[model samples]
Target: MADLRVLIVDDDFHVARLHATWVDAVPGFAALAPVGTAALALQAAHSLRPDLVLLDTYLPDTTGLELLRTIDTDAIMLTAASDPESVRTALRRGALGYLIKPFSADDLAAALRGYARYRRVLAGTGSLDQAGLDRARRALLGGADAPSSGGPSRSRSATETAVLEALAQGPGSARALLSAAEVAAVVGVSRATAQRYLAALAEDGAVEIQLRYGSTGRPEHRYGLSA
Candidate 1:
């Protein structure tokens, strides 16, 4: 299946880049260049016709809610705007998701995953039965897809999920290795906790481990997602 194309709109270049990185790290999404103004965002949306947009509530030219009213594609609000009025307006304007700022990559990944699943459920169909509609709604609201039967299943803890998402955002090259401390900072956990999760993931073949040898103390253990 083709990946979902995402256009990120935010006034802060750094925040936009971070969002793009998080969006790209998800399995079924790709992000276009970030735009800082509503005008540029509208132009890009017209030219690119992205599958979805990661929009902020604030922009240099106009409010994101205003742009959302104008755009023809789907959107998810990513902003520091915590006001209830802002949230209601974004939803009223047809935002598919709303994420407050200072969220971890894990949070964004979950939203992306949910949206992807929602799209999949509603794709290629002219009409839906009640069950189908219910499934699609559940998927859109962050419910996990039903697991396949007859296999031993182990659901990951929230911390484990966060750890995996952090690793998924790595550079994916020679320098992709991330230390436990780095993972800890990203996941908002202690280094020991991060290391424990990393070790567990490695044991489960969910991540790749590399050792960094130094002249000083012990070799530093680093991790990346398995290909």
Candidate 2:
């Protein structure tokens, strides 16, 4: 598959460049040169036909949410606007993900990974089953909740099996749990990939997650085989 082209739409040139660098670091995304105004953004969206837009809430000519309404591309609101109204509006406008400004690169990567997962889950032709549709939507949350199709009939994918195997080889104490990075190292995959699978497993009741709180940010999740 071709790398998903991303148009950076932020007024700050330096911030846009920094975000572009971060986007480029991910495996399957490419960032176009950043644009500062809604006018340039519209022109680029028309001409470039990018697969996604990393949009800032504040722009020179218009609000990012308003611009989002006019653009015909997928978008993630990367903005400083943390007001409840702004967040709710972005969701109503079909923004794939919303990241508050000052977010870490890991935060953005997680959102992008979730969006990629969403695209993959919905890519095939024909009408989707309820489980399939639910899975695709949950992918927007990075699969934190997993697919709800439970029971003995529920089967694990090859990658999920690999993640489980990695967990088995990890620290063998009753309370021991491994982070996604540790599992990724063992499985020879990116942390983001490992995280996506691990989160699903955790949510499906196939694995257990231990939330380890640190001094800052969200608590780190560690995984163990469910007993």
Candidate 3:
């Protein structure tokens, strides 16, 4: 498929243009004409049908989160707003990626890479089963750490705590990648049990998985502390 088209929405035309430039520079993305208002953004999205949007949260006509819910495409929110509520709301409103203001080009590229991965998973052959769908969303949003309707979590269990501790300490070999099996042995649990904890740890941003390529066959999955 061709590169995903992007719409840049920010009140400052310069910033919007800059975002468009950034989007265009990414290998798998193309930017549409920058729009400086929410009304125009809505209109553009409806008419142009871009694959993704680069939304500015501080729109003069309306709040970005409010616009986000009504838009058809996924978004990577751009804003100077540093409040926790804004982050929560943006993610809740179907934002696949969130980029705080004054970010580098590299940062935007990383977010785009994530969104690309998310799309690739969805576009793959056959259909995604429930767990596969969940994993794909996780790939998009970075993790499942968003608070539930009940509000933020208060605590972690013993096993969860131990898993976090192990992940904190690097797996000790640059050549060898950590796995649930290793973590399970360390925690004195089964690999399946270790995976459950590891999944939580990954959601909480404590661990990151890397693919290990061998001389032949399929690549293996390995774990490590998040950078």
Worst-scoring 10-residue span by lDDT in model 3: 143-152
Which residue pairs come into collision in candidate 1? none
Clashing pairs in 3: none
Per-candidate TM-scores read 0.66, 0.66, 0.60
Off by over 4 Å in 2: 144-227
State how far residue 215 of model 1 sits from its true place (Å): 26
**Minimal lDDT window, size 10, model 1:** 144-153
> Each model's C-alpha lDDT?
0.79, 0.81, 0.73
lDDT of candidate 3 at residue 173, scale 0 to 100? 48
lDDT of 3 by residue, 1-227 (tens): 56688888999988888777677655457789999889999999999999998988888899899998799898888889889999999988888778888999868866775676576567668977897788677766553321211112547678876765666664454333477778778788887567655544554566666657689853455767666
Q: What does candidate 3 score in Cα RMSD to the true structure?
A: 11.6
Residue pairs with clashing backbones, model 2: none
lDDT of 1 by residue, 1-227 (tens): 55689999999999899889777655447789999999999999999999999999889889999998899998999999999999999999999999999899879877887787677667755888888788877866776443210112477778888988888776666337899889989999887567656655654567777667789854567788877
Model 2: per-residue Cα lDDT over 40-93, one tens digit each: 999999999999999999997899999989998999999999999999999999
Better candidate number, 1 or 3, judged by lDDT: 1
